[model samples]
Structure formats: C-alpha cells, structure tokens
Target: DQQVKQNSPSLSVQEGRISILNCDYTNSMFDYFLWYKKYPAEGPTFLISISSIKDKNEDGRFTVFLNKSAKHLSLHIVPSQPGDSAVYFCAARGYTGKLIFGQGTTLQVKP
Candidate 1:
C-alpha cells in the first residue's frame, strides 16, 4: 500500500516567488520527514528535513513543516530561482528506518 501521496503532479512558480510543495501521508508511525530535489537524470539529493517531534525546520531558502495531527508535511522555498526547478520527492521514515516516498511533484520555476 502506498503510504505517502503527492496530490499535485506539478507546480509552476515565478522566479523570486515562494513555492510550496505539499505532501500527505497515511502512516502515523512515520518518525522522520525529508524532501529531495532531483534534476533531470540526476539522482535526488537531500534538500531539507524535519523530525516528527518538530513542527518546523528551516535551512537557508528551504523550510519543512510537519503536522503530525494532520499527517501532512510541506516544503517551502523562498525566492525560488530557475535553477531550483526540479522534481521534488516527499519521503517519510517509519520504525524500520526505511523510507517511503510519494509520487514526485515536478517544480517549474520560470524566470
């Protein structure tokens, strides 16, 4: 069963604007949240992460928020740039320490 899901398959945002990516999960056992950014053929790289104990975490232009009660999480990018365009994957780790990922959302940052 798919535990994580990204309802929107894609998102478009203007350069220099804020871009928000949303993800939903059904598993309450998940203990960690992470977002990965992938460019074309390249493998997805760690972008940002938030622990289940925290409601928010920020790293530079990126921020991740976890809402345990709602079983949802989001990634925010401020002042998005063209180079930031890529496929974003939302992942969660459960008791097994194995990651479950959602259907990626492709982000298009237009300059």
Candidate 2:
C-alpha cells in the first residue's frame, strides 16, 4: 500500500495568490514530515518540514501543517509566483531515515 498520497494531480493559481496542497498518509510510524519541490530533469529539493510533535511549521512563504489524529497534512504557499511552478511532493520519514513520498502535485502559477 502507498503510505502517502496526494489526491490532486495538479493545481493552478494566479500570481500573488495563495496555493494550497494537501496530502494524506496511512502510517502512524512516520515521525517527520517534509515537503519538496521538483522541477523537470532535476531532483526534488526540500521545501519545509514538521516534526510529529509539532502541529505546524513555517518558513517565509511556505508553511506546513500536520494533523496526527487525522493522518493528514498540507502545505501552503503565500503570494504564489510563476517561479513557484513545479511538482510538490509530500514525504514522511520514519525512525530509520527512510522516506515515503506521496504522488506529486503539479502547481502551475500563472503570471
């Protein structure tokens, strides 16, 4: 079974708006959650993360929320820009440092 999943295949947003991306997971063992941004022909780069003990984390325009009881998580990007267009991936890391990723969501920021 896929431990993590992104239900939306893609999202489109106008520049300077807020873009929301969501994710769900089946495994409670995952203690660390992270979001990554990927461009074509390149590897995914870390965007933001939250620990299991924390409910929310933020960094500049990126924020991540974790709901352990609901087994769900989401990423928010404020003032979305054309440069933000990319595949967003949600990932969870367990005790072993092994990461499980959700199916990516492609974000198209139209300027």
Candidate 3:
C-alpha cells in the first residue's frame, strides 16, 4: 500500500502570512519526495524535493522537511501571496517514474 495522504483538502491564509501543508505516507520504501504546485489548468510544477537521506530542503520561499522515521513530510511557504494560491501535491517517486501522489491541497490566499 503505497498511499500518500494529504489529510486536508484545502487551506486558506491571509497574504503576507505563513502557509503550511502536511502530508503522511504509509510506505517506508519511498525514498525520493517532491512537492509540486499546480495552477488551475496546467500541470504541476516541481517546487522542492528532498531525498530520504536528507531531513530538509528549501528553495526560495518554499521549504520541505521530511521525518523519515515517522514517514511524514511538510511544505512551508512564508509570506504567502496570492500567486501562491494553488493546488499542492505531495509525491514520491517509485520504480518507473511513477509517482504516488496525495489527493492534493488547495491553498487560498486572501488579499
């Protein structure tokens, strides 16, 4: 059961605030983790990634932290803006470039 879980279906935050998204996984074999941000119709764009060997990875306003022992990961965005409002998906790379994704979380940024 390689199921990645994003418990919250959506989140809302005021602009200039911090936005945090959570994800959990049952499979321990997943070694590569990624976070993707998706707009309305376009496909998800890679935002940040962390390998199982690392505990955290960051890129600009985005940061991802992984706790291998708990099989949990989180994405954090600071000073959230309207542009950051979109669907975020947590994925883990499997054998064949097949990524197991969570249901996704929609973040709404208020002006």
TM-score of 1: 0.97
Ranking by lDDT: 2, 1, 3
lDDT of 2 by residue, 1-111 (tens): 999999999999999999999999999999999999999999999999999999999999999999999999999999899999999999999998899999999999999
Encode model 1's per-residue lDDT on 11-65: one tens digit a residue. Answer: 9999999999999999998889999999887898999998889999999999999
> Between the candidate structures 2 and 3, which one is better when assessed by lDDT?
2
lDDT by residue for model 3 over 45-105, one digit each (tens)? 9899999899998888899999988999999999899999999999987656668999999
Task: List pairs with backbone clashes in candidate 1.
Answer: none
Candidate 2 weakest ten by summed lDDT: 94-103
CA shift at 78, candidate 1, in angstroms?
A: 0.2
- Name the candidate, 1 or 2, with the larger lDDT value: 2
Q: Of the candidates shown, which would achieve the greatest lDDT relative to the real structure? A: 2
**What RMSD does each model have against the real structure?**
0.7, 0.6, 1.3
Candidate 2 overall Cα lDDT vs. reference? 0.97
| Candidate 2 deviant stretches above 4 angstroms | none
Model 1 segments beyond 4 Å from truth?
none
Report the Cα lDDT for candidate 1: 0.95
TM-score of 3: 0.94
